[model samples]
Target: MSINHTLKTQPVTPAHVQQEVKLAQRNLANSTPKENTTPEKGTDVKLSALTQHIKADSPRDIDMERVEKIKDAIRNGELKMDYDKIAQALLQNILDDR
Candidate 1:
């Protein structure tokens, strides 16, 4: 199967170009500046509370000591994988999705 499409093009003259320029200038002259808005006091308070809660609940820095211990364990082949615990956790996650 094949499809054929045709496009129509307009020839631009000096008058056409001048008209476009005048239209653009008219639009610019008619444009107005938007008004600035301030949030209500209650909204500002709620936003600040949310920001503080987020900061408090999230970890700000990594525990370097714990990371080093895990790295050391891996290097010494002492890091053990508890397959049963992992499988149970995975299954619980799957069931929780329902």
Candidate 2:
């Protein structure tokens, strides 16, 4: 048996496709093994990266509000990232991941 397919890496959006293309270009430039593609904080894809505001309508973008709320929480002493909660959530995620 034989199988062949070409997987062309492409952007997931139209408005921000250019950014994805640029990231792809950078990815090609800094090509490495799949295991090593993600290097570090500055080099890796993060949750915050997924929080981009695509629409101009503020109400449409929940991430923007969430980000703002998080910043406000930090500023107003209303937010608390307990390690226990983090651990629990991580555990839940690991369980759910399976």
- lDDT per model, in order? 0.83, 0.77
Q: Residues 1-98, candidate 2: write the lDDT tens digits.
A: 43676677875677588789999999997886566456566666545533554423576546787898899999999998799989999999999999
Best by TM-score: 1
In candidate 1, what residue range of length 10 has the lowest lDDT sum?
37-46
Instruction: Give the per-residue lDDT digits (tens) of candidate 1, residues 1-98.
Output: 43676577887679889999999998887786546957656643445776777677555467878999999999999999999999999999999999
- Judged by lDDT against the true structure, how good is candidate 1? 0.83
Best candidate, lDDT-wise?
1
CA-RMSD of model 1 = 11.0
TM-score of 2: 0.31
* Candidate 1: residue 83 lDDT (0-100): 98
TM-score of each: 0.44, 0.31
TM-score of model 1 relative to the true fold?
0.44
